[model samples]
Target: MRLETEMNMLQAKIQAGIVKDETVGNTSRFSDANPNLPHFQDDLDIWLTRSERFAESKNWSRDKWSSSLSALLTGRALDCYGRLSSEQAQDYDKVKQALMKRYD
Candidate 1:
């Protein structure tokens, strides 16, 4: 009876260890397979098509096309930044003037 009980306990420990090892192995494999998954962009296809069209329209010179696209993207970013800054400045001035008037 004592020997049987010890054997049963040993078997249970081996089974539990196997289960824990399998779980850890599976989680590591899953994370490795999906590392750095990209965020899905709603207009990804449209953006790709536009980029291709732009490249083709310029006769597909790799350097020139890439440079042109880079410049265009930079200009757009700057324009957006300028607009945001101007709006923020106007709001700040308005608030400041309003506060001055209130105090006066």
Candidate 2:
């Protein structure tokens, strides 16, 4: 229930174009420790939303972000596409677009 509320609040801030990344807190590690299970679009949306906020603090290059994000995924879920190759990962925008296309 708490997580749902947080996500909803974050989504509202995003829709409002606040750009205040401060509101989007990373309560979950969202790394190897926190693996998001992808099944329905709702689940995917949560993960993607988290990913977008997580991407903000990242100063690394796009490839690095992609690889970093890849490391956070698990293959058990049908929508989970394992780790992404550096080349396949490309830039954050491309990767995000692809993910949004698939899971949004």
Per-model TM values vs. the true structure: 0.25, 0.40
Expressed as tens digits, the lDDT of each residue in 62-100 for candidate 1 is: 433322322222222223222332233224233223323
Q: Count backbone overlaps in model 2.
A: 0
RMSD in angstroms, all models?
25.9, 13.1
Clashes of each: 0, 0
lDDT (C-alpha) at residue 38 in model 2: 36
- The lowest-lDDT stretch of 10 consecutive residues in candidate 1 is 28-37
Name the top TM-score candidate.
2
Write down the lDDT that model 1 would get.
Answer: 0.33
Please report, in order, the local distance difference test score of every candidate based on alpha carbons.
Answer: 0.33, 0.44
Candidate 2 lDDT over 1-104, as tens digits, reads 44543443343233323334446754434333222323223465677677655555544344445544544443232233323333445455565666666665
> Which stretches of candidate 1 lie above 4 Å from their native place?
1-44, 74-104
